[model samples]
Target: MKKLQLSLLLMVFLVMAGCSQSETTNTEVNKLKETNKTLIEDYNKLVDKKEKLEMELDTYKEVDENSKHLTTIIDDFIHAAQKGDTATMQANISKEFTFEKQEEWLTAVNGEKNFPFYSDFYKTKLKSWYLQGIDYDKEKDFVRVFARVGYSDGEDSWYFEIIKEDGYFKISDLQYET
Candidate 1:
């Protein structure tokens, strides 16, 4: 009877040990699955962020290119203004621009009167000038380019409003800060 009781106790101990080991393995597997799910979620979020960054980078590149082209256009206009070439200046001006505005430019160029963005006035007054920046208005579908201009007395802010016409950009108006 002692030997039978001992055998029964040994078998019960073995069975309990096996059941606990199996439970531990199941718990480890569940934890691993949860960790894998979290890793997948984190990876997806990174991918989304990477895509958004790429799009923003592309937009900046396009803006840079546009700025370069616009600078060229404005440079040509400034050169024409320095020489008092109305035809070349008119070429850069938008067709939609008013004849009255054209007269203002003509008069300003001839030194008959003062208007903002007169390169001749700039010729006499400005020590140095450069484009500050460009902004696009989506609502109006127009662009404004700011210029950093410093004349003999003081620095002033100037801007040229640009618009697309006939699939090309043209200057429509000029302004100066008070």
Candidate 2:
């Protein structure tokens, strides 16, 4: 009877030990699952950030391409005017281009009155003019070109404003620095 009692106590201890081991294994599995969930969440956030950066890069590429094309157009127009090519100059001028003069105040000259002024300016002031630099404003959809202009007496700097219209870039305005 004592031997049988000892055997039963040993069996009870073995079963309790097995139950404790199983509980410990279950706790470890729960911790692993929680870690895996956090890693997946972190991976998803990184993927989202990468996608957003790619989209922004694409937008900047498009803007850079457009700016290059517009710069070429401006260069061609300046070259044509320098060579006294009226047809090319006229082609690059937008119909909506306004000829404005501001000495003390601003005044909009009629096209009929403006043509002669433009002609004289191009023929005389722009004879030795050359483009120095160009800047673009994507949000405003406009370009600013810096040029070295030659006057009859001396040389100076000038700026031209170009705008996009009907899928083409055209000279919209000119401003000379005093």
Q: Compared with the true structure, what per-residue lDDT tens digits does model 2 show for residues 59-102?
A: 55754677666556666666664455556666777776444544
Off by over 4 Å in 2: 73-100, 104-178
**Per-residue lDDT of 75-124 in model 1, one digit per residue for the tens?**
77766654566677778877654222353344333234244334333345
Full-model lDDT, candidate 2: 0.66
**Which window of 10 residues has the lowest lDDT sum in candidate 1?**
107-116
The C-alpha local distance difference test score for the whole of candidate 1 amounts to 0.71
**Top TM-score prediction, candidate number:** 1
The C-alpha TM-scores of every prediction are 0.54, 0.48
How much is the lDDT of residue 127 in candidate 2?
A: 48
Highest lDDT: give the candidate number: 1
User: What range of 10 consecutive residues in model 2 has the weakest lDDT sum?
Assistant: 101-110
Q: C-alpha displacement of 166 in model 1, angstroms?
A: 9.6
Residue 49, model 2: lDDT of 95
